[model samples]
Target: MDFEQGSINISDDVLKEIAFRSFIEVLAPDEKDVKKLKKSIEIERTPDDNVIVYVRTVAPYGQSLVEFGKKIMKNISENIQRMTELQVSAVNVTITDVVEKIETTEEEE
Candidate 1:
């Protein structure tokens, strides 16, 4: 897009940050675990100027990964498009690991 002044260009890092923040918002992972998710997001620009997003992360063992992935994709796509006005061709989510949700049991005093 162009204005009277000049054209606005959005950087890949900004795009990635938008997607990353969206992912974090939807996933709601533990604060400490957020670092683990930071490096897994990537943004690609297609020849046609469209965007493709790749996300890899771990999910809780009992959750439905397919549904979770779909949720992630939807959030990421919507966020990038809404924020940057970039056409998102796809948002691919890969579940890299599954960790069991730990349960804490209280001891009777």
Candidate 2:
């Protein structure tokens, strides 16, 4: 008797979802905000099974550097679990730029 099985592969949608969730969880933005935040957040996989995440957050940066790193790792772990078969060796997060925070006016507040 012979048994057949297939290996699991990570899909692009999963990667994008993971990236978006990670950003939202890390940033914790308010829903009523007028201006759009998070200019761009990208996730890419390297040939060596490494995940790279790039984030651009609105400034003045509220979250601490340490917290940011922790969130990235947490999100990666969660995503890996959801995917089941894909194993991530490491996750690297790079903050590309900081956008100025929008000042709230009296009426907006």
Candidate 3:
């Protein structure tokens, strides 16, 4: 937004936070997952002032990586654009690992 005096700028940290929160909302991650996510989200600002988001994460072993990546990309891009009113040049999702969903027995729960 622009005013007579100046314009409001969203910082890279804020953008990063939004991206992080957006990922959590989509994934509904657990405690262990949250820790991993904290280190995996990064924000890059382009010369033209657009933003690029890079996310490295683990996916469920049986899920399709392509569709999974697209899901994450869409969510991150929409969130950053909506919250900051800034263009997202790209949302690059790199699948770092694939883990199986561990199911606990009734007695262990």
Candidate 4:
């Protein structure tokens, strides 16, 4: 018996954007994080054409970076696979920085 799995080709830039969005999804929803945050991903293609994604992002100060990384990695990996059908070997999240979110005060507005 023979089986065929059609291949889906996705561009690196698109993957990076998807990863960024997914990373943002797991971030602490301080309006600051949503407004002033950024993230990047590097995808290393393997011998089998599968990819390992390395994500770099910031976390809210005093937040558990380990838990943040885990959530970001899991969410990004799942979104990538579900949307693109690409095989992800692993998602490694690196917390590049932790910044405090100043509480939004109406006086500042």
What is each predicted model's overall lDDT from 0 to 1? 0.82, 0.55, 0.80, 0.70
Q: Candidate 4 clashing pairs?
A: none
Residues 14-101 of candidate 4 have per-residue lDDT tens digits of 8877876887677645666443344356778788777788866656778787887788889989988898877889998766666685
lDDT of 4: 0.70
Best by lDDT: 1
Give the better candidate number (3 or 4) by TM-score: 3
Cα error, residue 61 of model 4, in Å, equals: 1.9
After TM-score superposition, the amount by which residue 68's alpha carbon in candidate 2 deviates from its true location, in angstroms, is 2.8
Evaluation by lDDT, superior candidate among 2 and 4: 4
**How many pairs of residues in model 2 come into backbone collision?**
0
Better of 1 and 3 by TM-score: 1
Model 1 per-residue lDDT at 20: 89
Candidate 3 local accuracy as lDDT? 0.80
Task: Tell me the lDDT of model 4 at 88.
Answer: 85
| Tens-digit lDDT string for candidate 3 (1-109) | 5879999988889999999888877667766556556567889999989999998777777889898889889999998898888999999997766768522222222
Model 1, runs deviating above 4 Å: 102-109
